[model samples]
Target: MSRALLIIDVQNDFTEGGALGVDGGAAVAAGVSRLLEAHPDAYDLVVASRDWHDADNDNGGHFAGEQAPDFVATWPEHCVAGTPGAEYHSDLATDAIDIHVQKGQGQPAYSIFEGTTPDGETLSQVLADRGITDIDVVGLATDYCVRASALDAIEHGQHVRVLTDLVAGVADESSASALAELAHAGADVVDSSVVAA
Candidate 1:
């Protein structure tokens, strides 16, 4: 099977001391980088997803302003398009990335696959064009974006595997529950080591 690594939302805004900093976000980056180094030939393709929001959009305002009373509402203004927060984390190895998908442009896209390219290409189409059948996902906010992407991958008919060691949740109980939910949805919950094998 042609496998691909889907690195989701490992941006500066999601890391430590950022707007919506998840606990151990930096550690997740380090772990993913190490995994890539250890298994360079295991996966032929690597894709990184980023939250590239527009500063003046509704989704941006909902978070920047106090209008919404959710966990995301309390976050600082981050990941604005072309800004430092929108960029990938420093520790993440970008040289291995074959595709970079930008999400949450005008709307709130929790799933990486939800965003479309300027040419109207969906994330799944991008992978399908590459002949990718198995996808291994790792990244931030397991209960949110990461979970959404994993579910979308499965829906797109790809065998989905979540690299538990290379991911960090939002430091909440829901994160663990989300992982369980994904497993129940037919996703393979494994570590980076297991993925390498």
Candidate 2:
């Protein structure tokens, strides 16, 4: 099985002490690193994504403006390009990543599919070129980017598995719902241990 590991938004701004910090983000980063360490051959490709939003504007309404952020469609200023907050978390093993993707540069992008690599190749193209048929997703905020990424993976005709234990989320209630939705949408909501196994 050709599998790709998609690490979504394990960035500074989404970790424990940054702008849109989510609980357990650090643990997820470390867990993913350990997974890769234990199972180096588990994935044919390793892709990590970040919310590299532009600093000047609201990023096509991805950020709040005239009113308070509803925390759903709009959020507070975060992950601005060239900022430390836009960088991956200290605990995440970014060195092992084969492809790096930056999204939300000037628009609202929830799926990694919306991102392009440094060489300007789309994520879907990368997956197809590499012959990746299965995808294992792990990272911060299970209710948001991680969820979107997994669902999109399924939509793109790939087998999707979400490393539940290797992910954090914005809230318990919403995160639970997101997991349920992902499962219903045909994703395998398994734990990180499954990767090691």
Candidate 3:
């Protein structure tokens, strides 16, 4: 079975010192890079996603606007398209990525599955076209994007594994709960070390 690596939202805004930064986000970036460099052939396809929201508008109420951001359904303005914040973190080696996905163009998007490639192909379409049957998920904000992406991958009829060490989250409790939920949903929650190149 073909395997793919799904790197979710390892962007500047999600890393330390940016809007909605998560603790250990930068480490996840570096770790992911190392994984790809060390296992160049481990995955048939390497895909990375970023939050590319529209700067001119609230992105369909995704941004809190005049109201304070509740950090739940609404968030502060971040990762505007063409901005540095929307770019992937420097620590993540983008040269290794075969596909780059941009999500939340003008709406609230948490999963990479909600994104599209430069060619306008959906992630599911890309995977199906490539015959990718197994996926290894890793990246920032585990409780949000990583969690959602893995669940969607499972729902899409793909085998999924979440590399715990390669992800960071917004909070401790929520991240733990999200991991538990993923495990319950049939995703193998494990460390990147367990994966063989």
Predicted structure with the largest TM-score when compared to the true one: 3
Give the higher-lDDT candidate: 1 or 3: 3
What's model 1's TM-score? Answer: 0.92
lDDT winner between candidates 2 and 3: 3
**Candidate 1 per-residue lDDT over residues 1-197, each given as its tens digit:** 79999999999889998878888999998888988888889887888889888887667444546554467544456688988988988999999888888887876678889776667788888888889999999999898899999999999999999988888898568888989999999999988778646
Cα distance off (Å), candidate 3, residue 90: 0.6
TM-score of 3: 0.98
Model 1 misses residue 20 by how many Å?
A: 0.5
RMSD, each candidate, Å? 1.9, 0.8, 0.8
lDDT of 3 by residue, 1-197 (tens): 99999999999999999998999999999999999888888999999999999999999899999999999899999999999888899999999999999999999999999999999999999999999999999997899999999999999999999999999999999999999999999999999987773
Clashing pairs in model 2, backbone N/Cα/C closer than 3 A? none
lDDT (Cα atoms) of all candidates against the true structure: 0.85, 0.92, 0.94
Model 2, global lDDT = 0.92
Clashes of each: 0, 0, 0
The candidate that achieves the highest lDDT relative to the unseen native structure: 3
